[model samples]
Target: MNVAAVLSCALLLAIWGLPWSDWLGHFPAHMIRHMGLVAVVAPLIVLGFPRLADPLALSPLAGAVLEFLVVWGFHLPVLHEAAMASSVVFIIEQALFLIVGLVVWAGCLRTGGLAGAGGLLLTSMHMTLLGALLTLSPRVIYALDHAGALQEQQLGGMLMLAIGTPIYLIAGLWLVARSLEDTKDEMA
Candidate 1:
């Protein structure tokens, strides 16, 4: 499982974090790429290899906060545009996405394992609200290399809602079920 998770992350980064990212240039593509890495890859790796927690001594709350700030900070038009023009910010952005993902999962695993329902829920809600804001906006929000800025932003919003939200919800519920099972076993 750990190897599979690592491979999955490697494949995703190769597609999104490398030259293809420059080739794609559209905001939604970038947003989906980042979301896919954090929401999908991070949880898979952490759950597969819990030993990863030792290196990143992070709390669930701090992890969530850091993830939230990094995600939103990057979405800001100025910074987003800067990343588009420069390679350095793009690299930094991708690194932060991976690190924040690991930190969030580590936070959950360290404190209560799957019993960290609140942290997971917080992550879900954060993605939902961000997506909703983008999707429901009356005007175009981003300056992209492509023509359909509004459409791209809307798609990005949908990806967050459709993809990110479900992943966190499932993970949280899975954790809750595991904790309950463990409790019953102990009682028995």
Candidate 2:
């Protein structure tokens, strides 16, 4: 609804277009897009459209679990392969990412206390674990339709670790601080 949220929507559109749009062909690029969707763009959209998720009435814990399943399930070899092979599947996968991401972010924003921090911290932990798994795997986990599969996969993992971790960690910490501040103010 605000300027920042509007700009975030534009950024989301830009990410899906142009040179960064080869998600099916480049593993690292795909990871970048994934991180942008779940971490960056989703939060902003929730800010702009807070009521969009109000109807769901999801708790932070429920939202986190739903998001975790959607993200990790799509990364499974079979599902990943299917998405890579078909445009329709890819679209479906991306749409789910955006939707679940919106849900998680909305839950966090609406809760905005220790509970929200916990949800975000949990998400950060799982994302780190997945990134580490992909980064340290001896062989390629997902069969890519391009060259340098192993290297690209590793880069993708690194990208997730680099991008997703810090954003979630910082946001979680920010929420914790805000919660404490509110409590202190109430006590005063």
Candidate 3:
């Protein structure tokens, strides 16, 4: 589909093949199951369709609630730990991510003329922050004992966020500006 979706899928494939897969083997069966759910399916959905902004058009309060749940829900320590410990939890977490991502993407899309650029940028910010939290936890929240691959996963997560954030912001601003200019010209 689009470049974003393509890249996400590629990344997911790479993660699946990495050394961490071995550690995942150690996790309880339920956790492994959930990991597959999130790791395999969530990205496909996000990258599969371009997000439309209108879905994000809830009242301010509702929007805030949605954002809160999306960003903080899975990251909660207990939830995170459970997900890492069991496959079922992991699947649930990924499902949450997919749902939240969809909502966020829709919000971006509804922004109208600047949908492309702005939506991408906001999504990037959301993703980067989420990744950072996942990667930067001081203690091993997920794979309690697997330090080696966990460390690597953390680093990779951080790198993705650090690199992706600016790119999204810049692209979003450019699209918004371009849309504004178009509007101005129309008025002129």
Candidate 4:
């Protein structure tokens, strides 16, 4: 847990540092940095938190679904355009991303192994699809600059695919391993 806390703090520093830097705050960096918060930092916070029972009370799959909606819905061109159009909307979008991300990770961490793993697998697949969509799109989806948007989108997608996808899969596999251990204990 202490290790988790340390990792969380490190991720936060990275997240906060990006916006201050002109070079790092751009398209692919911004998106990729946010993913670090969502997929890694948030999970570490959850696993490190002193009280785990609160989030564990909810259904893991429900959290996963909510995460899917929040992440996918917010990232879409229409919604992202709205966020970009206003500072308030952008703040809200980012807030929801962090909050929902925490909930989903907590749920996956605390729920029964099988349910968590199953939900995680589904989530990974959904994220994979989203990444593919972004990566394969020929035109720039966002109105941010329109020129470099395609390359940026593809980079963000590649980040999701290369980094985000593996986190979910590894977490799911870990849950599966835990499940097997518990089953063995019960059988014995």
Candidate 5:
């Protein structure tokens, strides 16, 4: 692997080692770490080891749906609470985040056209919607243990918007432009 790729892998491990709850409170920290995994780390890994993605045969649409389900399912009140309550559950949750992230990124990177763009765009939309809900909610949606203060919950949502939304949206748009260029090139 290239130095950059090795560094990114190390960074992923380092992020998990951080005491996110102590640094940014529970909810915001979790949100930031989650975003970092799926948005930053996952893409870096895909870019680093493109061949590693070959084993995954998921379509862009299916990859998006899988990612969406994993994210939302883990964020559900019951599951969220369990994760917060137990180290095992928390580890499982985090592992899944990384795994699904790799899958989605691999699929998108492999299929850099309308299919990739659409999947990424769809992910961006759902991420935005989820973030908005968390930010705008009057009452805390998740358990108090993980959600922390209401303000903290809102901040977490804001973090998601700040991190996940732009990354996915920009990636999608870039893929669309790439697709157009490829088509133009083929016609020439």
Candidate 6:
């Protein structure tokens, strides 16, 4: 929607592409880095941009669905495995990430509303659950384990949740605050 949002999406793509490009050999590390770039850095940047302030004003349900897809889809064993497999899988995964990122970014930057808050909360919860799942796993999941970087994969998953949840929560709260402020301003 704006330069910042565009850049955020670009950056996310780049991160997702690293493993496939062979710029990064470790899939788990790449995934972790990608998640960090998207879930953490991207949101903060989008939150600062005024142009993204009313995503719901554009397409409410679409934006919410995208957010859900990004967070929940990444956690699924099938999707995660596909993402770590090959170039084709990487492309699909990145595409999904981009769509999801746009939705979440739109929600955060555009009309700060209940839908925006719900999307942010959902993403945060999913990321937290993902981290917990990784930590609890007896062995690294197929995707990361197959990448031959089990230790890094496990660490990455833990780090994603550790870093991602806080970012999501803070952003969620900020969205909530903005929503309330808007309501108060409207009432006044």
Highest lDDT: give the candidate number. 5
Residue 8 lDDT, candidate 5, scale 0-100: 68
How does residue 88 of candidate 4 score in lDDT?
Answer: 90
| Poorest stretch of ten by lDDT in candidate 2 | 17-26
Poorest stretch of ten by lDDT in candidate 5: 140-149
Per-candidate clash tally: 0, 1, 20, 0, 0, 9
What are the RMSDs of all candidates, in order? 2.6, 1.8, 6.1, 2.1, 1.7, 4.4
Q: List the candidate numbers ranked by lDDT, top first.
A: 5, 2, 4, 1, 6, 3
lDDT of 5 by residue, 11-127 (tens): 787778878888888899889888998888888888877677566637788888998999999889899889989999999998898888888888887887999999889989988
lDDT (tens digit, per residue) of candidate 4 on 92-161? 8877877777877777777859998887888788888988888898887778674666787788788778
**Predicted candidate 6 versus true structure: per-residue lDDT over 1-188, tens digit per residue:** 66655775666565644553254346456556657555754564555454553442334356656656665676577876766667787676665664566557665556567666766776777667777777667776655434456665566577777777887788778878888999999999
lDDT of 6 at 42: 56
> How much lDDT does each candidate structure score?
0.77, 0.85, 0.53, 0.77, 0.87, 0.63
TM-score for each of the candidates? 0.85, 0.93, 0.57, 0.89, 0.94, 0.69
**Which regions in candidate 4 have their CA more than 4 angstroms from the true location?**
none
Residue pairs clashing, model 2 = 1-48
lDDT of 3 by residue, 1-188 (tens): 77766765665565444565454343322233333323333434444554532443443234324645654666566776786678897667666654554454444434435555545655565657766765776656554564564665565455545555665566567768878999999999
After superposition, candidate 3 runs with Cα above 4 Å error: 1-65, 113-143
Measured on C-alpha atoms, candidate 1 has an lDDT of 0.77
Q: Hey, what RMSD does candidate 1 come out at?
A: 2.6
lDDT of 3: 0.53
TM-score of 5: 0.94
Deviation in Å, model 4, residue 72 alpha carbon: 1.4
Global CA lDDT computed for model 2: 0.85
